[model samples]
Target: MPPFSQSTPISNGFSPNHHHQSTNIITIDVGGQLFQTTKQTLTLAGSNTLFSNLFNSSHHNSIPFLDRDPELFSILLSLLRTGNLPSRSKSFDLQDIIFEAKFYGVSHLLVQSQSNPSQFEPLNLEKSMLLPLSGRNPPSKITTTPNGSLFVSHGSKITSFDWSLQRKSTALTSFTGVDSLLALSSNVVAAGATDFSGLQILDLDLGVVRETLNWDNVTKSSSTVQGIGSSHEFLFSSFESGRRNSNSIVVYDLESFKIVTEVARNEIFGADLGSAIPSTKLNWVPSLSLLMASGSHSGASGVSGNVKFLDLRSGNVVWEIEETTDCFADITVSDTLSAVFKIGVNSGEVSYIDLKNFGSYKSWNYLGDARKANNVKKEGLGCKIECHGNQVFVGKQGELGLWSEVLMGGSKIGKDRIFRKNVLGRAKDLGGNRITNMGFGGNKMFVTRKDQQCVEVWQSSARRF
Candidate 1:
């Protein structure tokens, strides 16, 4: 069936053959080969695009000529009509299609067809492909844009892969290593390290630093970034004084990179464990209008940490939790789930706190065995946990676990709230190097393993690479 076809009936005794040549029927000549399509289908290409301009032009009767390949144009026409590529498009390289899409000013349409985030399937993810970095150093951090472009920091360099995952570019920075990285745009990224002086806004295409942001601490010394995060309008960086006595989380204007305000500023007084622990992880909860900052410290006694949800406007901690029992190895907040999740360092179990009744429930609702909270072996030493879509992904050793909520057909939280967990991938995909980090963009999950130089891409088998 055609996407759009308007048949005008013969009127005033006009013949059907004469009506067949109506202005609604569009004909195009690409490389001297003619193709026909309806004006309604071409209008879907959106305004300012080549197709829209061609149709909106004054020459309706004359066939438009385009100095392009007819084969690729046919595929693009199919896309405009059906909002998907034909099966035969597999024969052509993805790069060629991307180039043609750019020429037609319809690259966004191609991206929508291939890498939409709504297409992410947590259950069907498989170890599909590998993105190899060009150095001996393993990736310290990986970040992704909403459209699926990836940025990986290995040693002092950052490598970026386009949304299609076909082309990549590398840029070097002055830092010895990048401990935290956040992608601000397709070409700009905020990179920082614990040992580095300031957070650098880098341009990946030009391989240059656009601007450097630093915190004004009481110590009057340089500030090093512990973590970087962003909300819709603001960029947040957790910075600790080089003297290691003071720390603060600075909020900046995303557009201008100017310091808007500071929150969670702490100056360590003698033996105050809470003040000594600077937030190493920052997550913005858009739904609740809060920023969660968490950090942990290890000493001879045990590991202790704190998680604080701050109202940025007032610079006040709206909700706070102190961890003295089983400190979290890693933590992530799921806005869709309205919960904050963590994996305990000693228990090796997942836990959560309901954001709806946050202050009332001071204790974490352990999803697994609560008895193991006092384990001596440190079972969750280097585990990583992150939340994407409505699911939580946990990386323990070399294995990956997926946790999904079992809808009980109720909106309120009950005592028997259940979340089922399943190990991701087959047996062959398990038991490799220890998983270091994980990131998600578009329909793909990017995983980096300890001592591994390449980033593994886990994606749905149904989506074409």
Candidate 2:
């Protein structure tokens, strides 16, 4: 039947035609083009129901005018009435339906498929079954070492998984209350805890503690040591100073097992640089020799924030950009030497920093704002940023956003921004509201939600060169 001649019945009222209803439904025109119902409903109770029943009852395979198979027709009807389907129903093949729904532009079905790819069995046969229980929890962080082995951080311990074999090997013995982990190289991984001992280097291959370096003796409560990056011989760790004007960055010489140097923000930038402001977070880019970026809390008690880059070789500030007061939550660097920072204002904003083209003192630009597009203005307190090649991924308040660079002149010019383009797992609403941290390994993105006990993983759509 033509789309203009078809109608579907509902409990509330009668729709003149599926194509002319207020609710959205899947429709196929005479030419085989698909469309979503944006407007009316058709009630079949009076006369249309009898005809539908007669036609459905008489035809098993020879329904000459019906456009879709019986099973597919039922699924489409259910989706049109209810925004989503049950995650684990065995009545019909969900994978096929998901594809059909996506092809037909069913918004709700697309969201459901993304959140639970495993719901459609045959289509997602090769995909992993592990997924977050809800949309509020974050995924786990993953790192691949030089030896081609994979390490995934869940809660306080690092679990080793083999990529070739696709199985878990062994869980590394961990430090007390460690919350974050980073693979410095094939043999070395850095672990950070909420306590103030700074960062610890764990040998994943040997499953032993290689070295532990303390940041300072202060031991502030809930103080997290983050952004543990490394070079051939040195490991750098940054911390959010719990007290005013006290946050510092510690560099450890992996060979010496001693703190090579600890620089305060004032000394690294200037005594008056962020005097009114305190350091919130810091990150180091391995490709840029002795180059580090630090985000500071807006002066004293205000809402403004600033991020400054320092040249450790010269012990001087290279570039500093003051931003509208927002909580600078996390920052990360890509394999290509690009950097990204997550700024939590009334809403969240991401800034992409191109180290290759930055002058001595140039301000970075905001890549995009996720919250503004969603029309939601919630504070992004617990958020993390990580990059893989030209793509940057961020987790804010349980939602994931993906950004890709638009390069020009053989340099990264700007980013093509897509907000809430993907979601990993659900988050549990704890008052702490912390979107703990994130990392990447072998085409997978991991995110940790502190309030939620589990870590979630999302498969990357990126194709490796």
Candidate 3:
């Protein structure tokens, strides 16, 4: 059956093609797409949403929802009436559908769109699962040392391990919370605490604290230590405030553990930085010595999150990508390739930004059609995304999805493998759990789960590379 053919039941946004009395019907224009329905149907979501707000002042016909996509709205309307998506556009990706559904408050439609990926391209399967970190301590963040040992942080406690997953030593075994962890050198690790402990540098050999550094003229909060990034010499961490007046990101000399400089909250382009503004994540590009930070977006453009790239050499922000919808988080980089992921913290819709072209934001694209994946929701489950080299990893609780080399520049999708929530076996068979942090080094990947008592490490099969 043709979805848009003359014989279809929906004619001009009406099911029966019957003209309704003027006072009994309402027409809406979404991105120039036409929709007609009675006022009674729009009241299902109660009075706090877009449609309910416009109900009273809406003209009898031809109400306009400017800047909205009509195809999605049409689908949303069909879902409202029929309680399911229309049979039309079988090839329609779910991202746009989820976005439209969310925008229109079609709760049921959004739920249907977020199922696991049932179909996937072929893959060279691994008969044996790579499960390391069996008896390791509970971890909130994981990173590797220069020589290939793993440093797992569980706030006040830290654990060290060799490539073989043998536990070495535990440090700061008394602290209550550690928020983020970074490897500084072969025997040194940097930790940011959840309490006002600021940042601490530890000696891996001694399993002892070496240096503790705090920001200058900055107040500490429970979330003050959100994330941290490092280069060969400088340690970058977050501070608060919006304007360039107070520092949002601060640079410190790693060797001396002294304040190097403060980065104003992206006020470099003048002060129109948007809501919920805070430097929550940071990724420092090694070869270029450039830093990419993710925070609140610019309200002027109605964008939600800001991914700004800063040039450490020139001490200036070169470019930035302002976006909304996707959760701006866990930014990661590999060689010339950097991946920025947006997840529906409350929805399961996840997508990644494949930024290449030598640290330029202008040369970037979403690896998969994020708009379609809008249906893939984690809801309040909270997700963390990790990208190393060409591979992309998305972790939500115990569930994990691995997309290896799925980025093919110019909005093209590359051929890749697809694995479901069952890859990480936990409570039963193979399923997901809470994954808090992921780190990569020496062709090995380490995953940490907040819900599980021990961390997990996976090594690439010799043949997969």
- Judging by TM-score, tell me the better candidate of 2 and 3: 3
Task: Estimate candidate 3's alpha-carbon lDDT, on a 0 to 1 scale.
Answer: 0.57
Estimate the TM-score of every prediction. Answer: 0.94, 0.53, 0.57
Name the 10 consecutive residues with the lowest summed lDDT in model 2: 118-127
- The candidate scoring highest on TM-score is 1
TM-score of 2: 0.53
Better of 1 and 3 by lDDT: 1
Best by lDDT: 1
lDDT of 2 at 303: 48
lDDT, each prediction: 0.89, 0.50, 0.57
Q: Give one digit per residue, the lDDT tens place, for model 1 in 89-119.
A: 9899999999999999889899988888888
Task: Give the lDDT of residue 311 in candidate 1.
Answer: 96
Candidate 2 on 213-293: residue-level lDDT in tens? 664535443335755655677666766544434456666776776777766543223455454354434455666664455
- Candidate 2 accuracy as lDDT: 0.50
lDDT of 3 by residue, 280-393 (tens): 678887755678787653344333666678876566877777655554434455553344555544355445544444344442244444454344242524567766555556
- After superposing candidate 1, which stretches have Cα over 4 Å from the reference? 1-21, 57-60, 411-414
Q: Count the backbone clashes (under 3 Å) in each candidate.
A: 0, 27, 21
